[model samples]
Target: MATTSFGAMRGLLNVKFFQTNFSAMEHRSDIKKDNKMKEFQRILKSLYENLIMLELYPRSQIDLQVFVLESDGSYKSAAFNAVSLALMNAGIAMKDYLVATTSGLINNVAVLDLIYTEEKKQNCEFVMACFSQSKNIAYLSLNCNKINAKDFKNLVEMSQGSCDQISQ
Candidate 1:
Protein backbone atom coordinates (compact mmCIF):
# COMPACT_ATOMS: atom_id res chain seq x y z
CA MET A 1 0.00 0.00 0.00
CA ALA A 2 1.14 3.56 -0.74
CA THR A 3 -0.11 6.88 0.63
CA THR A 4 1.17 10.16 -0.80
CA SER A 5 0.68 13.66 0.53
CA PHE A 6 2.02 17.04 -0.50
CA GLY A 7 2.97 19.24 2.39
CA ALA A 8 5.00 22.31 3.23
CA MET A 9 8.43 21.18 4.32
CA ARG A 10 12.13 21.79 3.77
CA GLY A 11 12.96 18.86 1.52
CA LEU A 12 11.60 18.18 -1.93
CA LEU A 13 10.41 14.70 -0.98
CA ASN A 14 10.61 12.04 1.68
CA VAL A 15 9.78 8.30 1.54
CA LYS A 16 9.19 6.01 4.43
CA PHE A 17 8.44 2.29 4.60
CA PHE A 18 6.52 0.42 7.24
CA GLN A 19 5.82 -3.23 7.74
CA THR A 20 2.84 -4.33 9.75
CA ASN A 21 2.52 -7.47 11.88
CA PHE A 22 0.85 -9.05 8.90
CA SER A 23 4.01 -8.75 6.91
CA ALA A 24 5.07 -12.34 7.40
CA MET A 25 8.40 -12.05 5.65
CA GLU A 26 9.63 -9.05 7.63
CA HIS A 27 11.17 -10.06 10.92
CA ARG A 28 12.40 -6.71 12.09
CA SER A 29 10.12 -4.37 14.00
CA ASP A 30 12.13 -1.28 13.12
CA ILE A 31 12.19 -0.65 9.40
CA LYS A 32 15.16 1.70 9.72
CA LYS A 33 17.44 -1.13 10.79
CA ASP A 34 16.63 -3.23 7.78
CA ASN A 35 19.21 -2.56 5.08
CA LYS A 36 17.02 -3.90 2.31
CA MET A 37 14.10 -1.75 3.38
CA LYS A 38 16.33 1.33 3.61
CA GLU A 39 17.68 0.60 0.16
CA PHE A 40 14.17 0.34 -1.19
CA GLN A 41 13.28 3.67 0.36
CA ARG A 42 16.26 5.32 -1.28
CA ILE A 43 15.48 3.71 -4.63
CA LEU A 44 11.87 4.86 -4.51
CA LYS A 45 12.93 8.39 -3.60
CA SER A 46 15.39 8.64 -6.49
CA LEU A 47 12.89 7.20 -8.94
CA TYR A 48 10.43 10.02 -8.30
CA GLU A 49 12.80 12.92 -7.63
CA ASN A 50 13.49 13.62 -11.28
CA LEU A 51 10.03 12.80 -12.55
CA ILE A 52 8.07 15.05 -10.24
CA MET A 53 7.86 18.81 -10.86
CA LEU A 54 9.37 19.91 -7.56
CA GLU A 55 9.79 23.54 -8.55
CA LEU A 56 6.03 24.02 -8.42
CA TYR A 57 5.98 23.17 -4.73
CA PRO A 58 8.77 25.31 -3.35
CA ARG A 59 9.42 24.96 0.39
CA SER A 60 7.14 21.90 0.27
CA GLN A 61 7.67 18.20 0.31
CA ILE A 62 5.92 15.15 -0.99
CA ASP A 63 5.65 12.39 1.56
CA LEU A 64 5.23 8.83 0.42
CA GLN A 65 4.54 6.06 2.86
CA VAL A 66 4.71 2.54 1.53
CA PHE A 67 3.57 -0.46 3.49
CA VAL A 68 4.99 -3.84 2.80
CA LEU A 69 2.21 -6.34 3.16
CA GLU A 70 4.13 -9.30 1.89
CA SER A 71 7.53 -10.41 0.69
CA ASP A 72 7.55 -11.43 -2.90
CA GLY A 73 9.74 -11.30 -5.95
CA SER A 74 9.64 -8.12 -8.01
CA TYR A 75 8.35 -6.13 -5.04
CA LYS A 76 10.72 -3.26 -5.79
CA SER A 77 9.29 -2.83 -9.24
CA ALA A 78 5.80 -3.20 -7.83
CA ALA A 79 6.47 -0.39 -5.36
CA PHE A 80 7.56 1.98 -8.11
CA ASN A 81 4.44 1.25 -10.16
CA ALA A 82 2.24 1.64 -7.10
CA VAL A 83 3.70 5.01 -6.10
CA SER A 84 3.46 6.29 -9.66
CA LEU A 85 -0.24 5.46 -9.72
CA ALA A 86 -0.73 7.08 -6.34
CA LEU A 87 0.98 10.30 -7.40
CA MET A 88 -1.08 10.40 -10.58
CA ASN A 89 -4.29 9.88 -8.61
CA ALA A 90 -3.30 12.72 -6.31
CA GLY A 91 -2.95 14.99 -9.35
CA ILE A 92 0.80 15.45 -9.02
CA ALA A 93 2.56 16.97 -12.00
CA MET A 94 5.08 14.69 -13.68
CA LYS A 95 7.21 14.81 -16.77
CA ASP A 96 5.92 11.42 -17.88
CA TYR A 97 4.39 8.22 -16.61
CA LEU A 98 6.89 5.96 -14.85
CA VAL A 99 6.74 2.27 -15.63
CA ALA A 100 8.90 -0.40 -14.00
CA THR A 101 9.39 -4.15 -14.18
CA THR A 102 11.78 -6.96 -13.27
CA SER A 103 13.40 -9.33 -15.69
CA GLY A 104 15.89 -12.15 -15.19
CA LEU A 105 18.21 -14.40 -17.10
CA ILE A 106 17.64 -18.15 -16.68
CA ASN A 107 19.84 -20.55 -18.59
CA ASN A 108 21.06 -17.59 -20.65
CA VAL A 109 17.47 -16.72 -21.66
CA ALA A 110 15.75 -13.51 -20.69
CA VAL A 111 12.48 -13.92 -18.76
CA LEU A 112 10.02 -11.36 -17.46
CA ASP A 113 8.24 -11.11 -14.09
CA LEU A 114 9.76 -13.95 -12.15
CA ILE A 115 8.02 -15.30 -9.11
CA TYR A 116 9.95 -15.93 -5.88
CA THR A 117 10.96 -19.41 -6.90
CA GLU A 118 12.03 -18.43 -10.38
CA GLU A 119 13.88 -15.39 -9.09
CA LYS A 120 16.14 -17.55 -6.94
CA LYS A 121 16.98 -19.73 -9.92
CA GLN A 122 17.88 -16.81 -12.13
CA ASN A 123 21.49 -16.17 -13.05
CA CYS A 124 20.80 -12.45 -12.75
CA GLU A 125 17.85 -10.15 -12.24
CA PHE A 126 17.28 -6.62 -13.52
CA VAL A 127 14.99 -4.06 -11.90
CA MET A 128 14.33 -1.16 -14.23
CA ALA A 129 12.11 1.94 -14.41
CA CYS A 130 11.54 4.19 -17.41
CA PHE A 131 9.26 6.96 -18.61
CA SER A 132 6.35 5.47 -20.50
CA GLN A 133 6.25 8.17 -23.17
CA SER A 134 9.95 8.92 -23.61
CA LYS A 135 11.15 5.39 -22.89
CA ASN A 136 14.09 6.93 -21.03
CA ILE A 137 15.38 4.91 -18.13
CA ALA A 138 14.91 6.50 -14.75
CA TYR A 139 16.49 3.70 -12.74
CA LEU A 140 18.19 0.35 -13.25
CA SER A 141 19.49 -2.24 -10.76
CA LEU A 142 21.21 -5.48 -11.56
CA ASN A 143 21.01 -8.07 -8.81
CA CYS A 144 23.84 -10.40 -9.58
CA ASN A 145 27.33 -10.68 -10.94
CA LYS A 146 28.80 -11.74 -14.28
CA ILE A 147 26.31 -11.39 -17.10
CA ASN A 148 27.86 -11.15 -20.56
CA ALA A 149 27.30 -8.02 -22.60
CA LYS A 150 25.03 -9.75 -25.12
CA ASP A 151 22.89 -11.34 -22.41
CA PHE A 152 22.77 -8.07 -20.49
CA LYS A 153 21.51 -6.31 -23.58
CA ASN A 154 18.87 -8.96 -24.04
CA LEU A 155 17.68 -8.60 -20.44
CA VAL A 156 17.49 -4.81 -20.80
CA GLU A 157 15.43 -5.18 -23.97
CA MET A 158 13.22 -7.72 -22.25
CA SER A 159 12.75 -5.41 -19.27
CA GLN A 160 11.87 -2.48 -21.53
CA GLY A 161 9.28 -4.58 -23.32
CA SER A 162 7.82 -5.69 -20.02
CA CYS A 163 7.61 -2.09 -18.84
CA ASP A 164 5.84 -1.14 -22.06
CA GLN A 165 3.28 -3.89 -21.59
CA ILE A 166 2.72 -2.80 -17.99
CA SER A 167 2.28 0.80 -19.09
CA GLN A 168 -0.37 -0.24 -21.57
Candidate 2:
Protein backbone atom coordinates (compact mmCIF):
# COMPACT_ATOMS: atom_id res chain seq x y z
CA MET A 1 0.00 0.00 0.00
CA ALA A 2 2.94 2.28 0.65
CA THR A 3 6.72 2.46 0.34
CA THR A 4 9.21 5.02 1.63
CA SER A 5 12.85 6.05 1.48
CA PHE A 6 14.70 7.80 4.29
CA GLY A 7 17.75 9.98 3.79
CA ALA A 8 19.80 12.55 5.63
CA MET A 9 19.82 15.68 3.54
CA ARG A 10 19.90 19.45 4.14
CA GLY A 11 16.58 20.73 5.58
CA LEU A 12 14.70 19.79 8.73
CA LEU A 13 12.12 17.07 7.97
CA ASN A 14 11.00 17.14 4.35
CA VAL A 15 8.28 14.72 3.25
CA LYS A 16 7.08 14.35 -0.34
CA PHE A 17 4.34 12.15 -1.71
CA PHE A 18 4.44 10.74 -5.23
CA GLN A 19 2.10 8.93 -7.66
CA THR A 20 -0.78 11.18 -6.72
CA ASN A 21 -3.08 9.26 -9.05
CA PHE A 22 -2.62 6.06 -7.11
CA SER A 23 -3.07 7.72 -3.71
CA ALA A 24 -5.92 10.00 -4.68
CA MET A 25 -6.67 11.47 -8.11
CA GLU A 26 -5.79 15.13 -8.48
CA HIS A 27 -4.91 17.60 -11.19
CA ARG A 28 -2.00 16.49 -13.38
CA SER A 29 1.06 18.40 -12.25
CA ASP A 30 4.75 17.78 -11.68
CA ILE A 31 4.08 18.16 -7.93
CA LYS A 32 0.99 17.57 -5.88
CA LYS A 33 -1.04 20.78 -6.21
CA ASP A 34 -4.18 19.68 -4.42
CA ASN A 35 -5.06 21.10 -1.01
CA LYS A 36 -5.96 17.67 0.30
CA MET A 37 -2.55 16.34 -0.71
CA LYS A 38 -0.89 19.24 1.02
CA GLU A 39 -2.89 18.60 4.17
CA PHE A 40 -1.96 14.93 4.05
CA GLN A 41 1.68 15.87 3.67
CA ARG A 42 1.43 18.20 6.65
CA ILE A 43 -0.22 15.57 8.84
CA LEU A 44 2.43 12.98 7.90
CA LYS A 45 5.22 15.42 8.60
CA SER A 46 3.75 16.25 11.99
CA LEU A 47 3.45 12.57 12.80
CA TYR A 48 7.09 12.06 11.92
CA GLU A 49 8.11 15.08 13.91
CA ASN A 50 6.42 13.56 16.92
CA LEU A 51 8.11 10.15 16.66
CA ILE A 52 11.55 11.01 15.38
CA MET A 53 14.29 12.29 17.65
CA LEU A 54 14.93 15.48 15.72
CA GLU A 55 17.31 16.90 18.30
CA LEU A 56 19.79 14.14 17.60
CA TYR A 57 20.17 15.24 14.00
CA PRO A 58 20.20 19.00 14.59
CA ARG A 59 22.14 20.11 11.54
CA SER A 60 21.08 17.20 9.33
CA GLN A 61 17.87 16.92 7.41
CA ILE A 62 15.58 13.94 7.28
CA ASP A 63 14.16 13.36 3.83
CA LEU A 64 11.29 10.94 3.38
CA GLN A 65 9.75 10.07 0.05
CA VAL A 66 6.50 8.14 0.28
CA PHE A 67 4.86 6.45 -2.68
CA VAL A 68 1.34 5.26 -2.28
CA LEU A 69 0.52 2.49 -4.72
CA GLU A 70 -3.08 1.95 -3.58
CA SER A 71 -5.54 3.16 -1.02
CA ASP A 72 -9.09 2.59 0.08
CA GLY A 73 -9.41 4.27 3.47
CA SER A 74 -6.79 5.12 6.10
CA TYR A 75 -3.97 5.46 3.57
CA LYS A 76 -2.31 7.95 5.88
CA SER A 77 -1.92 5.19 8.40
CA ALA A 78 -0.21 3.10 5.73
CA ALA A 79 2.13 5.97 5.04
CA PHE A 80 2.92 6.24 8.74
CA ASN A 81 3.76 2.57 8.93
CA ALA A 82 5.89 2.78 5.81
CA VAL A 83 7.90 5.73 7.02
CA SER A 84 8.33 4.24 10.46
CA LEU A 85 9.80 1.06 9.06
CA ALA A 86 11.99 2.99 6.68
CA LEU A 87 13.34 5.10 9.55
CA MET A 88 14.23 1.96 11.47
CA ASN A 89 15.88 0.48 8.40
CA ALA A 90 17.88 3.64 7.87
CA GLY A 91 18.95 3.57 11.53
CA ILE A 92 17.31 6.83 12.38
CA ALA A 93 16.77 7.56 16.06
CA MET A 94 13.10 7.29 17.03
CA LYS A 95 11.28 7.32 20.33
CA ASP A 96 9.30 4.24 19.37
CA TYR A 97 7.30 2.60 16.59
CA LEU A 98 4.56 4.99 15.57
CA VAL A 99 1.71 2.63 14.88
CA ALA A 100 -1.49 4.10 13.50
CA THR A 101 -5.05 2.96 12.82
CA THR A 102 -8.44 4.28 11.78
CA SER A 103 -11.53 3.34 13.73
CA GLY A 104 -15.15 4.42 13.82
CA LEU A 105 -18.58 3.54 15.13
CA ILE A 106 -20.72 1.65 12.68
CA ASN A 107 -24.27 1.43 14.09
CA ASN A 108 -22.82 2.32 17.49
CA VAL A 109 -20.30 -0.50 17.29
CA ALA A 110 -16.57 0.04 17.16
CA VAL A 111 -15.01 -1.04 13.87
CA LEU A 112 -11.33 -1.18 12.93
CA ASP A 113 -9.57 -0.56 9.62
CA LEU A 114 -12.64 0.40 7.65
CA ILE A 115 -12.62 0.19 3.88
CA TYR A 116 -13.93 3.04 1.70
CA THR A 117 -17.46 1.75 1.88
CA GLU A 118 -17.24 1.08 5.59
CA GLU A 119 -15.95 4.58 6.17
CA LYS A 120 -19.03 6.03 4.53
CA LYS A 121 -21.22 3.76 6.61
CA GLN A 122 -19.65 4.79 9.91
CA ASN A 123 -21.15 7.53 12.00
CA CYS A 124 -17.91 8.83 13.47
CA GLU A 125 -14.24 8.31 12.58
CA PHE A 126 -10.99 8.66 14.48
CA VAL A 127 -7.40 8.42 13.28
CA MET A 128 -4.85 7.73 15.97
CA ALA A 129 -1.14 6.92 16.19
CA CYS A 130 0.86 6.02 19.25
CA PHE A 131 4.24 4.91 20.52
CA SER A 132 3.73 1.15 20.44
CA GLN A 133 6.20 0.25 23.14
CA SER A 134 5.04 2.89 25.59
CA LYS A 135 1.36 2.89 24.64
CA ASN A 136 1.47 6.65 24.56
CA ILE A 137 -0.50 8.55 21.96
CA ALA A 138 1.45 10.54 19.39
CA TYR A 139 -1.43 11.81 17.26
CA LEU A 140 -5.22 11.76 17.34
CA SER A 141 -7.80 13.22 14.97
CA LEU A 142 -11.56 13.02 15.17
CA ASN A 143 -14.40 13.59 12.71
CA CYS A 144 -17.92 12.98 13.80
CA ASN A 145 -21.23 14.78 13.66
CA LYS A 146 -22.00 13.80 17.23
CA ILE A 147 -21.18 10.85 19.45
CA ASN A 148 -22.04 9.70 22.96
CA ALA A 149 -19.31 9.23 25.53
CA LYS A 150 -19.71 5.46 25.67
CA ASP A 151 -19.36 5.09 21.92
CA PHE A 152 -16.36 7.40 21.84
CA LYS A 153 -14.60 5.44 24.53
CA ASN A 154 -15.19 2.20 22.68
CA LEU A 155 -13.83 3.66 19.48
CA VAL A 156 -10.63 4.81 21.22
CA GLU A 157 -10.14 1.37 22.70
CA MET A 158 -10.67 -0.23 19.31
CA SER A 159 -8.27 2.17 17.65
CA GLN A 160 -5.53 1.52 20.21
CA GLY A 161 -6.01 -2.23 19.89
CA SER A 162 -5.70 -2.05 16.13
CA CYS A 163 -2.55 0.04 16.41
CA ASP A 164 -1.06 -2.54 18.75
CA GLN A 165 -1.83 -5.33 16.32
CA ILE A 166 -0.25 -3.42 13.46
CA SER A 167 2.84 -2.77 15.54
CA GLN A 168 3.28 -6.50 15.98
Candidate 3:
Protein backbone atom coordinates (compact mmCIF):
# COMPACT_ATOMS: atom_id res chain seq x y z
CA MET A 1 0.00 0.00 0.00
CA ALA A 2 1.25 3.49 -0.82
CA THR A 3 0.45 6.24 1.61
CA THR A 4 0.50 9.94 0.98
CA SER A 5 0.65 12.40 3.85
CA PHE A 6 -0.31 16.05 3.68
CA GLY A 7 1.46 18.63 5.78
CA ALA A 8 -0.13 21.92 6.72
CA MET A 9 1.08 25.24 8.12
CA ARG A 10 -0.86 28.13 9.59
CA GLY A 11 0.02 31.81 9.48
CA LEU A 12 -1.55 34.72 11.29
CA LEU A 13 -1.62 38.45 10.49
CA ASN A 14 -2.67 40.50 13.53
CA VAL A 15 -2.05 44.14 12.80
CA LYS A 16 -3.17 46.81 15.20
CA PHE A 17 -3.06 50.53 14.53
CA PHE A 18 -3.74 52.59 17.62
CA GLN A 19 -4.03 56.34 17.65
CA THR A 20 -3.07 58.38 20.67
CA ASN A 21 -4.58 61.83 20.97
CA PHE A 22 -1.14 63.40 21.04
CA SER A 23 0.18 61.52 17.99
CA ALA A 24 -3.09 61.87 16.06
CA MET A 25 -2.17 65.44 15.25
CA GLU A 26 1.08 64.25 13.73
CA HIS A 27 1.55 61.67 10.91
CA ARG A 28 -0.21 58.87 12.74
CA SER A 29 -2.42 57.93 9.82
CA ASP A 30 0.53 57.88 7.46
CA ILE A 31 2.56 55.82 9.92
CA LYS A 32 -0.22 53.30 10.30
CA LYS A 33 -0.67 52.97 6.57
CA ASP A 34 3.03 52.43 6.07
CA ASN A 35 3.14 49.75 8.74
CA LYS A 36 0.16 47.99 7.21
CA MET A 37 1.80 47.97 3.81
CA LYS A 38 4.99 46.55 5.28
CA GLU A 39 3.03 43.84 7.06
CA PHE A 40 1.21 42.91 3.87
CA GLN A 41 4.54 42.64 2.03
CA ARG A 42 5.93 40.40 4.76
CA ILE A 43 2.95 38.06 4.51
CA LEU A 44 3.30 37.80 0.73
CA LYS A 45 7.00 37.08 1.07
CA SER A 46 6.45 34.31 3.60
CA LEU A 47 3.67 32.65 1.61
CA TYR A 48 5.81 32.76 -1.52
CA GLU A 49 8.71 31.07 0.22
CA ASN A 50 6.45 28.36 1.61
CA LEU A 51 4.88 27.61 -1.76
CA ILE A 52 8.28 27.47 -3.42
CA MET A 53 9.43 24.95 -0.84
CA LEU A 54 6.40 22.81 -1.54
CA GLU A 55 7.39 22.73 -5.22
CA LEU A 56 10.76 21.29 -4.20
CA TYR A 57 9.15 18.07 -2.99
CA PRO A 58 9.98 15.07 -5.22
CA ARG A 59 6.35 13.99 -5.59
CA SER A 60 5.01 13.74 -9.12
CA GLN A 61 2.38 16.29 -8.19
CA ILE A 62 1.37 18.29 -5.14
CA ASP A 63 -1.75 20.00 -3.95
CA LEU A 64 -1.70 23.21 -1.94
CA GLN A 65 -4.70 23.92 0.28
CA VAL A 66 -5.25 27.06 2.31
CA PHE A 67 -7.98 27.67 4.86
CA VAL A 68 -8.95 30.95 6.48
CA LEU A 69 -9.91 30.53 10.11
CA GLU A 70 -10.91 34.15 10.59
CA SER A 71 -12.49 36.44 8.04
CA ASP A 72 -14.51 39.64 8.05
CA GLY A 73 -16.37 39.54 4.74
CA SER A 74 -14.50 37.48 2.14
CA TYR A 75 -13.83 34.33 4.10
CA LYS A 76 -13.11 31.82 1.37
CA SER A 77 -11.90 34.57 -0.94
CA ALA A 78 -9.27 35.43 1.64
CA ALA A 79 -8.03 31.83 1.81
CA PHE A 80 -5.86 32.01 -1.28
CA ASN A 81 -5.93 35.81 -1.43
CA ALA A 82 -2.20 36.02 -0.91
CA VAL A 83 -1.39 32.97 -3.07
CA SER A 84 -1.01 34.79 -6.38
CA LEU A 85 1.25 37.37 -4.81
CA ALA A 86 3.31 34.56 -3.33
CA LEU A 87 3.42 32.67 -6.61
CA MET A 88 4.57 35.80 -8.40
CA ASN A 89 7.28 36.30 -5.82
CA ALA A 90 8.44 32.71 -6.25
CA GLY A 91 8.13 32.76 -10.04
CA ILE A 92 6.15 29.54 -10.30
CA ALA A 93 4.42 28.41 -13.46
CA MET A 94 0.84 27.21 -13.31
CA LYS A 95 -0.99 25.52 -16.16
CA ASP A 96 -4.35 26.14 -14.53
CA TYR A 97 -5.40 28.45 -11.69
CA LEU A 98 -6.99 28.22 -8.24
CA VAL A 99 -9.39 30.65 -6.57
CA ALA A 100 -11.76 30.36 -3.64
CA THR A 101 -14.51 32.47 -2.04
CA THR A 102 -17.46 32.13 0.33
CA SER A 103 -21.13 32.96 -0.09
CA GLY A 104 -24.17 32.93 2.14
CA LEU A 105 -27.91 33.37 1.80
CA ILE A 106 -29.19 35.54 4.61
CA ASN A 107 -32.85 36.50 5.05
CA ASN A 108 -33.53 35.26 1.52
CA VAL A 109 -30.75 37.50 0.20
CA ALA A 110 -27.63 36.05 -1.35
CA VAL A 111 -24.54 37.77 -0.05
CA LEU A 112 -21.16 37.50 -1.77
CA ASP A 113 -19.04 37.23 1.38
CA LEU A 114 -20.39 36.99 4.92
CA ILE A 115 -18.67 37.90 8.09
CA TYR A 116 -18.87 35.63 11.16
CA THR A 117 -22.16 37.11 12.35
CA GLU A 118 -23.83 36.97 8.97
CA GLU A 119 -22.72 33.41 8.45
CA LYS A 120 -24.30 32.47 11.76
CA LYS A 121 -27.69 33.84 10.69
CA GLN A 122 -27.54 32.52 7.15
CA ASN A 123 -29.46 29.42 6.13
CA CYS A 124 -27.11 28.47 3.29
CA GLU A 125 -23.33 28.49 2.87
CA PHE A 126 -21.21 28.04 -0.23
CA VAL A 127 -17.60 27.97 -1.23
CA MET A 128 -16.85 28.74 -4.84
CA ALA A 129 -13.66 27.59 -6.59
CA CYS A 130 -12.31 28.99 -9.83
CA PHE A 131 -9.26 29.40 -12.04
CA SER A 132 -7.20 32.28 -10.77
CA GLN A 133 -5.94 33.56 -14.12
CA SER A 134 -8.76 32.61 -16.49
CA LYS A 135 -11.64 33.38 -14.10
CA ASN A 136 -13.22 29.98 -14.70
CA ILE A 137 -15.09 28.09 -12.04
CA ALA A 138 -13.76 24.70 -11.04
CA TYR A 139 -16.20 23.70 -8.30
CA LEU A 140 -18.84 24.94 -5.86
CA SER A 141 -19.79 23.40 -2.53
CA LEU A 142 -22.76 24.43 -0.41
CA ASN A 143 -23.31 23.69 3.24
CA CYS A 144 -26.43 23.94 5.47
CA ASN A 145 -28.67 21.98 3.14
CA LYS A 146 -28.89 21.88 -0.65
CA ILE A 147 -29.47 25.02 -2.70
CA ASN A 148 -31.59 25.49 -5.80
CA ALA A 149 -30.17 26.13 -9.26
CA LYS A 150 -30.97 29.85 -9.19
CA ASP A 151 -29.26 30.38 -5.86
CA PHE A 152 -26.33 28.37 -7.13
CA LYS A 153 -25.96 30.66 -10.11
CA ASN A 154 -25.99 33.72 -7.89
CA LEU A 155 -23.27 32.22 -5.75
CA VAL A 156 -21.11 31.70 -8.81
CA GLU A 157 -21.45 35.30 -9.85
CA MET A 158 -20.62 36.65 -6.39
CA SER A 159 -17.68 34.30 -6.05
CA GLN A 160 -16.43 35.36 -9.45
CA GLY A 161 -16.21 38.91 -8.11
CA SER A 162 -13.83 37.71 -5.46
CA CYS A 163 -11.69 35.93 -8.04
CA ASP A 164 -11.56 39.04 -10.21
CA GLN A 165 -10.34 41.19 -7.33
CA ILE A 166 -7.57 38.72 -6.53
CA SER A 167 -6.43 38.37 -10.13
CA GLN A 168 -5.89 42.11 -10.34
Which candidate wins on TM-score?
A: 1
Q: What is the alpha-carbon lDDT of model 2 when measured against the actual structure? A: 0.78
Name the weakest run of 10 consecutive residues (lDDT summed) in model 1. Answer: 1-10
Per-residue alpha-carbon lDDT of candidate 2 for residues 38-106, written as tens digits (9 for 90 to 100): 788888888787678776775567889987776677776777788899999999988787988888888
After TM-score superposition, the amount by which residue 151's alpha carbon in candidate 2 deviates from its true location, in angstroms, is: 0.5
Candidate 3 lDDT tens digits, 1-168:
222333323222222222233422223366674674465445434434333444334333333334333335443345455455445565555454466778889977888767767877898988776766667666566787767888877777877887677566
lDDT of each: 0.81, 0.78, 0.56
Candidate 1 vs. true structure, TM-score = 0.82
Where is model 1 more than 4 Å wrong at Cα? 1-11, 19-33
Q: 2 or 3, which is superior by TM-score?
A: 2
TM-score of each: 0.82, 0.79, 0.53
Query: Residue 75 CA error for candidate 2 (Å)?
Result: 0.8
Off by over 4 Å in 3: 1-75
Number of the top candidate by lDDT? 1
lDDT of 3: 0.56
